[model samples]
Target chain A: MSVLDRLAPELITGAPLLVMQGIAKRYGPVVALEDVAATVWPGEVLGIVGESGSGKSTLLRMMNLEDTPDTGTYTLALPEVAGNLFDLDRFARRQLCARRIGIVYQNPHQGLLMGHSSSGNVAERLLVAGERRFATLRARAREALDVSEFPLNRMDDPPRLLSGGMQQRVQLAKAIALEPALLLLDEPTTGLDVSVQALVLDTLKRLQRDRAITMVIVSHDLGVIRTMADRVMVMRRGRVVEEGLVDQVFQDPQHPYTQELVHAKL
Target chain B: MPNSERGAMVPGAVVLQVEGLAKSFQMHHLGQNLHAFDHVSFTLRAGEFLLLKGPNGVGKSTLLRTIYRSYLPQAGHVWFSHGAGRTDLAHAADVDIALLRRREIGFVTQFLIARPRVAAEDIVAEPLRKAGVAAEDALEQARHWLATFGVKRDLWRAYPTSFSGGEQQKVNLARALILPPRLLLLDEPTASLDVGARAALVARLADLKAAGVAMIGVFHHPGDVAALVDRDLMLMAKEVDDVAV
Candidate 1:
């Protein structure tokens, strides 16, 4: 049985938390993303599958608001805000990002502060969200670390001293400390050893199921997408070629490019 | 012996012999000595591939470095059999060791240290040039290996220092394998490489094994190299014994 089945059945259900339509982005002469549309429902896990330079990362960056979609209606349904994200001013978008989004990059170093202690790294996210009390910050940080299964004894150790897998755990803890509604992961286990990759994936699965946090994970590894994603989207050359339930797509891929990808994995 | 499918007969005589290998470090701040390994012994035959397995901090990497003569072992002997003669790498003269390294031994580490302004192709060809191959011939051969490792032809002229970790690692592998050394020591060679690059490396290593090159490699994921490895060496952390002052 899938690990997700063991956790409390996803309790959150409502209108999709995020919606994008006709998203298009370009870098000079290069078309990075083109008319890509996706909807992430509350408590859903969406896996974006594509090789390098396939617009998967571009779509993710647009969702994170790191890059604005040149043309599209990007909507994030947060309690306090309801409108196209690209329509917001930079300052307003930044506020919404701080409040509602958590991102974990493929490189753990990019997501983590190597100089700060592990717990300090987790606590810093809360501090940025305006939590000032030391006791509360410490408590929340410890809780997040516990959820990620990071060793509490090494809470004071900087990330540089930790192994690659441990550093990823710390990054996961820090990203989820704020309990954001949406989590964005880009090739989270790409470089980790197989055993360590299993651990990180297990932790992510447990957290996603228990907390019912929505997620969009991008990876070139079909194994990762097969294990983690509830729905799968396949992109090729800056456009979505296929999208469907994970089982449906895996069993009978409609797009020729997706069929080639699935065959390569097998 | 794992009975590798390669079934290539290893040389009857051992290519490398180690006895009573021990290494330790003095932790001055902690006022204690860290024992890396103790009384380690092994023999590697020509054309045999040995996989070193152990957890972190167990001295697997330290043992590899000591064999390469980069790190000094407190007490041990590493006898490397070469065409000229058997040289105790543990106690070899500096000049002899340097010459042996250039001609007989090659080590590939996880990271590459490329000099600034040097093109990737030149970096791969440097070893051959040092060994007295013509620059043109060396570079031509370097291009062949670079292409084998899947490095784009256009990037061959650019500096490797700016390449991504996987790309630089491919360059490092090309440089080490270009000369086709008698004995190769690899530490996590596939750590940074992608699936395609890794498969390419495995294929190249298989070819080298068929050609009778002995190797000792440390792999975090042994399954990746299982088809090539003939034997396994497991290292355990040594318990530190307090020396009474």
Candidate 2:
């Protein structure tokens, strides 16, 4: 059964899934972000592209509640929670990050418990949420693995035993098992072999479509962004220099930096 | 990489992306600028072969040199996938470029630059020898490459300077393929070769493609290698932008 069938029918706010304003962050004297504002509507895929130091990642981390903006306010905008995510108690923010959001990193090692069985990795989230039945855990994890396109027989293998692409698939499986309202991907296909990258991206594109899941993807590769995002934001020196429909920004960028970046891509 | 332009790209680590690369030369005496190639941009994943096609003097050779850092670009960046990260070739340090040349990158041109008195075998073996392979073993490997490229064994001990045009081009190709670099840049490598030898080189390149080597090649006649090319970069002729000297 799909994991969505197991949801407890929690109330979701009619407001946009995310709302942030005047976000600013700095490391020592170096400004990492400045007055960045963004809003992501539910079920919309927003692509973030930038050079290495362009604050696109810093912005994503803030959205995931992994990093906090020093000046601006941003929140999950859940109907149940009236306060910004940072203002909540540490435990509350952690709970929201864990239950309501899913994240995939470029390296699966960062997300997967390497030594744990693939099924163990996927069930860990469900277990943490207080599910105690072994059969249910196994079943749900199996279903998630199916959606991830991972070979069902390999479910018992540890991520350490899987190929780089397969380990990434396991990460996708674990992330989606939670049925997160927001999925955050950071360079999801950056390091895989070219042939394998195509497969993983195909799987990701399919998963996103099947679930109609909201995603905010941060990738340096424009080709990666083009495949999945409807809208894109180009960031430079920690500020959003351009934002528009992906085609418009790529084909006819108003900002010169955006133009250079677009044309610079293959 | 065939359908990569349509949005789905290969899953391998990106091996090369030449970004907005442009090159031109300043004629000091004439006080005019001569543009080679401009606005050149393309990306290659490992194992992809990109054929650079253009009219004479459109700067296909210049574009290759700019990527190799033989000619400094007039504009743009060459982002080469270096290990887990990437290097902008246009701004990379000479020492770094030197190391990359010895390890990950290889270049081949139409003319063979043979040193005086160096035997054809030793010339092909030079790269492996410098990489610390035993001299005898390096030469043995060199002979294997030479044979694969259709070079006659009788020429093994002879100096390449005395070889025919086709023979020298074969020797040049053998030397470049000796190391099987991750990124190979070819500048009209088949220009000096006869039909049979050109076919030999093309067959050898097909083998390299299967071994996952990325290549950027300039060819006047791409018909023979068309089967191996993943993308064709058509460089249009550029109008010289005369600048104040």
Candidate 3:
């Protein structure tokens, strides 16, 4: 069965939780992104697929506010905030990201604290969200760990002690512990084995179904896009070559670039 | 490959044998004794990659250090079989251990400890120089490894102390692998490396294993190097017995 068929039904009727328009970014001498537009609805998974230097990661960084767009109107349906996200100051952006967004990097270690225990890593997000009581933090950490299928007994062990798959699970647990409104995953399974990749993807799918979390996944792996994305955005050289339903894009890619990508994988 | 197939490839003789290995530390201020591990025993074969798996503070590092003679085991024998003969690293004299290290062992740790003014290339070539290799040849090999690890040509003459953590780690790996020792001990060698560098290191390690260099490695992310592992040695807390897979 196709991946989207196994997940919870999409809630397409609701207003989009995020919207971006006219997003453009430029590095010192090169244009990293140009005129990119997208919408992420609640309870939806959007996958961005492209090769290296395609600006998919740059777009993700902008969505997470790690980098500002040179020109764009970005809006997040965050409670008590109605202004454009691009207008927020650095400190405000950091605070909003900490409390409202969860991000998992391509390298699991980048998203984790190597010196801290698994439980400590999970609890850190809660603490950042102003959770002070140890009992409360531990309880929330255990709940998140359970959702990620992390071994409860190994909670006190640091990330260095865990296997690659287990370390990715800890990263997932830490990201979801705060119950962020938006989740950003950047090539989450790029460096893992096929079996381990399947496990990580399954866990992510389960979390999406159970929590109804909105996510933006960026990957060059077509399999990951096919399995996890409800909608796929095909990008090349800083432009969106094609955007459509995952099945539609896979079965009948319109653009030549998208067709080439699909054919190469087949 | 299955463990049996690996064992069959190197028949009859073990590369490293550890028996009754034990170590403990005394906390003078707290007035407590901590035993790292007790009565641990294992056998590693030539061309084998043994992955050490365990929780933090479980003595994986301690066991490796003891085997390398960096830490003196309270009681044990680390019999490393070499071309000449077997040497007991656990009880060997300092000078003998030093000599054996030069020719038989290559250890890569997380940190690099180069002299303040030493250039990156020279730091990597120091081991070969000590082994009496010509300076020009050693530097050439060093430059080759630096390029393989993705260290830029401009950084070859720069001091490692001024390099980034990842750059320093590449230099450390290049230094350790220059001589192709009989036994290699790696402690989180890829911890500080980027994705490209990690892949390069993994490929290089695979070549070394195929060339019959026995290795024991502790990895923070074992998945990156999972293909090379032939067996697993799991160290647990003092209360539980260590498990060998």
Candidate 4:
């Protein structure tokens, strides 16, 4: 079948879900971001890549609304709330992020609550949202764990006792449990074993098939970005150097910095 | 006979006029000047198919880039027909060239550079999207073009990066022709195709020519496009021997 057939023409028709323009961020003498602009269309995966100090993580953090930009506009256009998210107060933005966005960090330890059991960890956000019934929270947690392909028998185990991959799976379970409009992943498989990384990436691939869940992924691993992202943004010195289709950027990189990055990997 | 002036006899308005075009690279460290081609001139009219023939490194592809304004012409004038008149592309401002590239010209290369996981249909539909066409309408039209080019329905969803060379070329052609620019520059588009695929491509070019989309192309096999070509320009690498390195 044609790719468009699988997408259902109507699935991709709409205004962009998020728009960021002229976004700049700085920490005293350190510039984390500068004059960057990007747009995230619903149902498309945009990959941000660069070397260590290129601000890829900063950009992803900004996308998740965890950190605000010093100057620029970030607009979140959703079914219920459509306006410049930058202008909203912290309390309102935090509320919006809780409901509309999900995030996965590079380290499983950072994303998961090791003290809680796997099931509790997954259902924590739901509990915070005021789901008080014990049976319903258990059901939702189990369902999300199943979606991430984590073993059902391990649901009661604390993430600290589970393997690295399983810990990340718990994080995945929690992130998708909310079914937010957008999912932001920062180095989703950075620290796992080579074998475990493959498993985690496959889980990401399976979850990625649901086009309705738009994603913005940040990775320093070119191979990971090449495999998962439909479009890529190459960052250098806190600025976006090149943005294009993944293959286009890899095969025919426009900027000199991007060329060096692509060549280094090759 | 190869460089014979035939555009004068073609019954259409001029689409491209290149006069005394030349390009060379300066090898500063090597203390040598590498000359690609020199004293070349040609005219292409609307709806005409112009073929460029040359040996390897003879600047045939460079000439096409010069006309497309991808490279600077060391000394020349490239007059392109736009809206109602013509602009000397050699001297046109960057903004003017950008506008013309968007609305009037397209350049297709030998290898396909596309993103992985992006369906071929979306790749073909990209030019239209850049032109502000709606996604649904542009995608519907892209499907039609892919079908016309004989890209399999199953392959439409496959990534173009995984396709065979010939299949990639077909995808490349579909993208360049989706918007049907007034002038199209193709560099070795038929380089890797088998026989039947080459014929299918020539046939498609013939249809485009009939629709008045003028074209300048460099092909590996002249026989593949002979029937569609309105004229041919033969270019040769300029011999330069003096060097200080």
Worst 10 residues of 4 chain A by lDDT: A2-11
Query: Which candidate, 3 or 4, has the higher TM-score?
Result: 4
Worst 10 residues of 3 chain A by lDDT: A2-11
Candidate 4 lDDT, B1-245, residue by residue in tens: 00022112233878888877777654433456777787878778888888887688888887887776665557767888755357777666433454577677878787786664568998899878766778899899989878877788999888887888788988887887777677889888888776665676778778778777789998877788888887777776663221111
Clashing pairs in 2: A192-B11, A192-B12, A193-B11, A193-B12, A194-B10, A194-B11, A194-B12, A195-B11, A197-B11
TM-score of chain A of 4: 0.92
lDDT of 3 by residue, B1-245 (tens): 21231223343358899887887754433456668887878888888898988899898887887787665566767888875567677665443454567677778998996544568998898777766678899899999999999999999999898888999999999998887777899999999899888998999999888877889999999999999998888887863343555
What would the per-residue lDDT of candidate 1 be over residues A106-175, giving only the tens digit for each residue? 8877888898899999998898888999999999999999999999999999999999889888988888
Evaluate residue A102 in candidate 4 and report its C-alpha lDDT on the 0 to 100 scale: 81
**Superior candidate under lDDT, 3 versus 4:** 3
On lDDT, the candidate that comes out on top is: 3
lDDT of each: 0.81, 0.79, 0.82, 0.77
> Which residue pairs show backbone clashes in model 3?
none
The digit string of per-residue lDDT tens for model 3 on A15-91 reads: 67989999988888899898999888776789999999999998998888898888988899978567789899988
**Pairwise DockQ winner, candidates 3 and 4:** 4
CA error at residue A204 for candidate 3, angstroms: 0.9
Error of 1 at A259 (Å): 0.6
DockQ-based CAPRI category assigned to the predicted complex of candidate 4:
incorrect
Error of 4 at A155 (Å): 8.3
Off by over 4 Å in 3: A1-12, B1-245
Q: Write the per-residue lDDT of candidate 1 for residues B90-109, one digit (tens) a residue.
A: 66643355456767788989
